[model samples]
Target: MSDSLFRLDAAQLAELIRSREVSPVEVVQAHLDRIGGVDPQVNAIVTVAPDALNAAKAAEAAVMAGEPLGPLHGVPFTAKDSIDTAGVPTQRGSPIFRGRTPARDATSVARMKAAGGILLAKTNLPEFSYWIESDNLLSGRSNNPWDLARTPGGSSGGEAAAIAAGMSPLGLGTDLAISVRGPAAQTGITSLKPTHGRVPMTGIWPRAPRRFWHVGPMARSVRDVALAFSLLAGPDGQDAFATIAGRAEVGAGPQSDRPLRVGWMVGPGFGPVDPEVVATVRAAAEALATFGVQVEPVGIPALERDFALDVFNRLHVMEMKPAFREATRGHEGEMYRMAKTMLSLPDTSMADFIDAEQAAERLRDGYADYFSRFDALITQVLPIPAHHHGADKFAIDGQEVDATYLQGATVPLNVTGLPGLSMRFGTSRSGMPINVQLVGAWHAEATILHVASLLESVSPVQGLFPNI
Candidate 1:
């Protein structure tokens, strides 16, 4: 029964809690037990909230008293360690901020709690949440739950791993390049990187150059992501960029019976993709077609120019380097290797940043034009499945590729400030999860999520659990 409790999705857990079939205390304890049993092997959760059980007790009391409950009432959720959690430590995966605790919850965390979600723990990330792998001086390395020796994908790797391993039902993770979606793909879960600024960034660490940064949910199901997104969206008064409208009805909308046009791509555009990864995406496209959706292989010529990653890298360095230099001015030795490598490099010149911004505009315009025709674009989240841990270089289908190419498919949506989602569509020959990305125009989360929800109904990887 405890195992069954940990296996339920957040929405299912909430329903059970609301119906008195399962107490909030029982739900929270089941997850805590799962974490205790499995997290040692994965190192996904860095810090467990000391008051989680107490919060669950209170939630149970609310149920017993016949109080009105929120959407996620009694559902346990985790957040990336870089997200502020009020009294809980948010170490940002660095020894530099080891014991740091924010005085206030991040806007997303507050919203989740307000919706009756219990904060369970802080998951791991790369130092300063900068790298594609979740490892740092503060909390060691997080192993992939599926393979144990491979990466789960990063900066949000631990968030994905925890959810995939059933240690938590749902959680929040920030994306700049591929943090949320890539990790979800690798771990066989689901995630949404809402259009930039759709959710508030207040209280999240490394919060500069807000245009490309976004925070959204990572969960076992697409509906769970939509539910969390509905609650997390909208202006928080503190984050200037979060002044957009919310899409709370996205998940609840009826599935369309009308034929939809879908575009699919495997790139000469993004980078070299593994044969298995391409096949997985193609299979998912075929599945959509089977549902009366018109699917076609399409290409975006701009993606061939590869401006997406360049735009992200240029702006990211321009915004982060100065602050990083100051933060580690004399404590360089205390920082992680990746942080040292990044901060020691030359900074992006104003002229270079200006050029990148211009290119970003072109990238956005290109996607806007393309989405004007297609309902949504589908592609690989990463070129390959989860790779071996601590690898310095990657070989895809027997050919070596730059490790940074992992950001290929995901960075483009960030450049456009568009919504993109990832879900496990198939499994690799080695049995690791493979995911596909679904991208839509700005503020088109509803459209993309609706398509994702449809795909979820037929996903080959649905109901599959990691061996961890």
Candidate 2:
């Protein structure tokens, strides 16, 4: 396995390497070379490890010695910068914590290593992982893999761009507010924001997104995502948020998917979605019908005001205040700067936060009720494809909408603690990738992955890259 090997998914490469058909060294080299080539243009990855080769060699020796294998067995992947990697310069995409190193790997990182996955790099993200753009003082900005002028979508933008460009076969991304799914949509990749709390966020920043954040896999295909996810998910004692949820098992035998009831929500739960986005999603729904899925257009009134508006934003803003203070100490940086902009508003009253939580409970109950009726929910991640770099808000067919409310259909799921998968469906008229999200009931990742796996097979999203 040299740097020439960019096309194999995490599972494919791991199996070959486990059988000695390929070496970890080759896989590491392939990724490094790929990054060296296209990363300069896409800016997807911020840090490159010169010692990744050494780690691969060590893993290769263990394999040669006939040692017991871990789940990943020497696969390579990247992590969102917000997650701590022992000894890595995890700056959290800001200058305040620039060059900061944790003495121990985060619980998730340690688990991945325990499963035999190697950290190839730390991906770029927005300052504090709070914004749509993956730009900051430390790692700079990550551009879309398809077009340099557009965003890759944050705060997991770098991971999505890298995975899309085949720089890494798989990677770990944290999604709170569409950080993972939005990037998947923008860059034409596959990602999962697992059932909230399914994966631990031991070393990630803002800690506020904990209840909202999900650490999941970003890859070239549904199978790759499934493989990566199986390795990273589980309960680690360190994460209070990691509840006792059942982890989805990868297919070890002849497992067949069952016919599913899919409720497709197009508009009104949010705003006017782009005709192109609607058309692309509708086409995929038709394709899934051939796979024995009942894809019916439906409306969801739960997410309407049940999730609440300014109250929902305030809930997040209030939770972030303490973390922001801890990071900045006393001065104004991007993290603090953004924090002040939100916290400066005395208008965000304590009553609002309490009311939002009450509303969130109602939204949760509504989702739970809805799931009892349908196997999964199909919707858009972004109202449209990734916007131009300088565009302020997303507009659908000349109608303007807030970036947070529209582009990210992810917030409500977080509010309800459900699972969501971001699957690339097609390219937009501008030639950028478009993605649709499939949301499942709490702890129903197997069902969500099944639908994603089925749709990935039939839709135009099937160009799972060649050896990049």
Candidate 3:
């Protein structure tokens, strides 16, 4: 096996293909081979595309025949099981949809393929993409690339694990609050959640997240993320949220002559955070200062701990009932019980939905005001590193917190419908990834990506190498 080929970044492979130094088929084959080597132990991929090799061959033919190519031409990537893939079974890590395969690729998958990317496999996710841990009846569980007994984090855990293990350079992962960002943090990959409507949420599972869910790129490098964003950002007619993709897309804004100003919350609307996580956030901010940016702590008292948790739980309970109510009635046992609990809550009535929407609006307005003054917001993707596998609850700084708190640094963005990104800040002692988020103004992912690129350059969060 050519280890170097599997290890090459998407941009590196693109350069080689563009220079006629390597064929697209060769690049795609390398990723397939990488999956073969590592995916068994990790169980990150649920369904492999038998025709990926053929697709890559066709891409090579296109290049050889002098056809127009997309920016990610010949890059190999994966999609989360929750996202539809044509001709591939999208089990969504649930038995309820066991034999389900869409007649069409998801808007995101179609966009990636159209951009010259080869979709090799469908990655695993939690059942119905509901829980934080990535395990389900149909696809089973995904283990962390660094530690098998530990979680890679979910519902995009499989995507994160595969990318971290070099099974693929990039994967399409969705985030309601922190699925993409959280898993990326746990597995040592980088991701960007474009503004809610910037990318189409069509074909993403639980389909109810139309209001808050965002589908975006998970990659090993910031540049790869930017490249993925470019491919995935175009308008798709099926999605209602996507408005004017032509203008919503990211690119170089006016070149800044002044060092950027950064405002970071010590924690979320919460008071104190884990020492290690706070250290990581502080270290990340200090690292940014060295990049010639002004870093200062900014507080969002309105978005405080209780309020953030309230927003997260209310949204989860209210929004997810429709997606899982049917599944619970049919499916039995633990997973069914979990879904029941989410649906069983009383605070999720029609009035509650309206209230949540109103609260979401207020939250959005708050972020608008917050971003009005600051160029970027820096914060922890979570209060601490990955907990034991399948653990329901955790504590930050000795205070008991629930799974909802896991979305601490993340929920506000979702509530307000703003774009926020999480990238690897550093690594925890256990080799778990410590990550930070950069929340920019509404559609200003370019600024956040720019600063994240700066942080990625200095952090010890190295992209995974191929074990194949």
Candidate 4:
């Protein structure tokens, strides 16, 4: 029973707990036990919440007492270590902030707890949450649950790995470029990067250039991601950018009665994608088409005109360097590779910075143009499946590219503040997970999630878990 409990998704656990069929203590203990047994190999969990069972006991008491239960009542969830967890260590994957614990939860974490979600643990991340892999000097590197030698993708890699390995049912992760979606794709889980500012960034680190950063949920199922996003969205009045009011109505089908129009693409703008990935995107598009939705191959001219990854590089380095500098001050020796690499990069030239800013606007306008004609977009989340750890270069589809190319299909969503969902849809020849990205217009999370749910019904890889 405990083994099956560890395998259940958050929604399923919540229902069982609410109905008294499964005690909160049993559910939480099952995950805790799973973590103890598996984490030595995965290294996904940074610190298990010492009071997790206590919280679960309290939730169980509420269930027995006939108290109103939250959506995630008694369900254990983890968060990337970069997100603050009151009294739990959030070391930001660096020795510089080792043993650091926050007095307050980040808005997302607090919201999750308010929804009756138990804080199961905090997961790993790259130093300062800046790299494409979840490895740092403080907590060491996290390995892919499917293939230990491969990365799970980062900076939310640990959260992804943990959820994939059944250590947690749902988790929170932050995304600047591809942290949330990329990691989810790698680990064969589901994740939602809600429209920018849809969720507050309060209590999360590297607050600079906050416009691009997002806090979102990572889970094993689309419904769980949708449930968590509904609970986590809206303003805390603390993050100025989070002024959007009211929760996004998840599970809401398209706003209109018309057939949803979705465009799928893999090239011209997203860079050299693996043929396997391209096929996966096409398969998803075709799957949707057969499901009575209008799906077609499409491209956004703005993506081609201005490579979003390059534009993001020029703009963010100038805006984000200060915060990195402030955090790494006098602690350079303790910093990890990403921090050192970020600090060593030369500042963006004034001309290039201005050009990049204009390019960003143009990209946004281009997306606006495309969205006006389409309800959503489908694309590859990453160029390829999870790569080996520490690899920096690859020959993808006959073109030699660097690791940064992995963000090609993902960064544009960040630049435009659009919402995107990553979910497994195919498998690589090497037996790794392959995921297709579902993108929606700003504040159109429901639309994309609706489409994702539809696709989830037909996903080739549905119910597939890593062989951890």
* Candidate that scores best on lDDT: 4
lDDT per model vs. reference: 0.89, 0.78, 0.80, 0.92
lDDT of 1 at 81: 97
Worst 10 residues of 1 by lDDT: 248-257
Query: Residue-wise lDDT of candidate 4 within 267-358, one digit each (tens)?
Result: 79988989999899999999999978888888788888999999999999999999999998998789878888888999999999999999
Taking the tens digit of each residue's C-alpha lDDT, what string does model 3 give over 1-468?
256687667888888887778998888878888788888899999888878889888888888988887878887889999899999888877677888989998899998888888888899988877778898777788998888888989879999999889888888998877889889888877898888888998887877756778899998888888878877885688888888464322335325676688987765575347787788888989999997788998887567523765766667676677767765565656463356566767756777767766777777777777876778889888787877787877777888877767877777777777777888777677667788888888778888888887887788655544233
Instruction: For residue 60, give model 3's deviation from the true position in Å.
Output: 1.8
Rate residue 29 of model 1 by lDDT. 99
Candidate 2 C-alpha lDDT tens digits along 1-468: 454468777888888888998888888888888888888888878777556888899999999999998867778888888888887778787888778887778877787788888889989888888778888777677888778888888889998889888888888888776788889888888898888778888877767846777788898888877766776677788788786655564332113365678888766665678888888878878888997777798776777766434445867777776677677775474553345655564545877778888888888877888877788888888888888785676667788776665544677777777888988887788788888898888878888888888787777757644222
List all candidate RMSDs to the true structure: 1.6, 2.5, 2.3, 0.9
Cα TM-score per model: 0.97, 0.94, 0.94, 0.99
Q: For candidate 3, give the lDDT.
A: 0.80
Off by over 4 Å in 1: 248-258
Candidate 2 stretches with Cα past 4 Å from truth are 1-4, 250-258, 307-311, 333-340, 464-468
Question: Among all windows of ten consecutive residues in candidate 2, which has the lowest summed lDDT?
Answer: 249-258
